[model samples]
Target: MRRSVRSPYTIDLGQLHFSLQYNNWPIGYVESTNDNITIHSGENAIQFFGELQSISSESYNALSTVIQNFLTGQTSKIEVLAGPNATSYPLLAAGIVGLSLNVHMPPFSEQLIASLIFKSMSLIPSTNTRNVMLSASITIKINSPLGQQSPLNIQMMNMSVFLLYENDSVGMLSVYQAPVKQL
Candidate 1:
């Protein structure tokens, strides 16, 4: 006779209390609307939404103007505040909050890769030259379930991205946004 192994025991807290702070200002708590920030706990996920003005109306307007100036190439960057009354974070313009995304890229077949390689090799001349040049096209498909369900019309803009580790800059990549049909 074999004895069945038991699963690990676990405890779930029905309700949890926590305080949220933005720019050092206490925004609000989860599932409560004392301030501008509002959070909702679902069966599988927790969602929250808030605006920059929620922290402080004065800071919001000031940051908005600063953002406008920066976008117009007037200012290099907006200032960051980190004092007892600080309410500003760098690169945080007026926008929505609590946005989440799940993106994935599916694998392609080897046949497609072989076809692209042959087409690219056709560009090279069949001569006794050591140096030859060739070019190939690469297709990258990005999928997001939440994005597909969104009803709002979205337009992506060109932006520069910098990868950093431990607050130190590592590398940069320039991204150009374009529209693609969902497949």
Candidate 2:
């Protein structure tokens, strides 16, 4: 008679500790099928946006907040105030518009996404991680080729973002830059 036997080797921590999170924005960007569009090939995007006028639009603030929170896995305690116009707050302002962090969680990996920059400077974060996702709303302050009159407004409002981060034991800065790949 042959009997089935069991050989067991198990990791016994009894009480395991881990965090589970699933988050995303419903009213987010819808991707355009066109891949021929060029993105951020200009001189300096960060600086470029700075020169442009800013709006008191909560859209930009919300977008920035989501990005910072998602990347850092933390909540922002301050209440961000919106202005009457887009140019009210400088592109770069005195206060920290979004939350920042320094994380050092192990098992680090990065995912790169291709996205386009809109005239209004909002970015639609790509969908990747199971927990966190971001959506952007753009408001153009200037009347130009990329404004509402121009159909390019929608196309310009696209962006790609890195979407995974584990809280480091000794959190200093939340891992933000996933790095842009070079051709």
Candidate 3:
């Protein structure tokens, strides 16, 4: 007579640990436990409700911090590791060890400057003239994650912008005082 047997290997998934980072800066962490985690097999999802203190520093003025707090508060990098119990399975630990992050940006459009020179633009066309004169002002905007809903402030500054085509300087955009805004 032949007997049937089944492998006892199984993973709880709740025994996994996740470390999240934003733009190479550590942000927060999530530890899954049997108590706070529930595995939904039918839905193919794992739900957990718990609290972990943020690991970011308050003194540092890094760009990651600004993006997380003010802008898009999303994890740009993630490191997955096996918990104490899950480490016993070498195969599972080997497969889940790495830093991987996926970010999907939706369609976005915004106007940087209302007018090119703060006035009407005039383009003159001449039959025999090959040289064209061009002047422009530039403004750089750093919008919050909330987009246009953030506060608005405008300031003016001077900067040099060059336009090149085919590795050759086609024109130069010289701005004496260009308006700059920060939110």
Most accurate candidate by TM-score? 3
In the predicted model 3, the residue pairs found to clash are 155-180
TM-score of each: 0.20, 0.16, 0.32
In model 2, where do residues sit more than 4 Å from their true spots?
1-28, 34-55, 74-183
Query: In model 3, which regions exceed 4 Å deviation?
Result: 1-11, 35-42, 49-90, 103-183
RMSD of each candidate?
17.6, 27.6, 13.2
Per-candidate clashes come to: 0, 14, 1
Colliding pairs, model 1? none
Query: Regarding TM-score, does 1 or 2 come out ahead?
Result: 1
Using lDDT, rank the candidates from best to worst: 3, 1, 2
Q: Tell me the deviation in Å of residue 179 in model 1.
A: 2.3
Weakest ten-residue segment in model 1 by summed lDDT: 85-94
Over 1-183, each residue of candidate 2 has an lDDT whose tens digit, in order, gives 111223343211111111111122111221112222122333311111111111334545554554455344554332212222212234322232332222222221222122444434333444774333333332333323233454322222323434345743431222233233222
Off by over 4 Å in 1: 1-19, 25-29, 32-138, 141-177
Specify the poorest-scoring 10-residue window by lDDT in model 3. Answer: 1-10
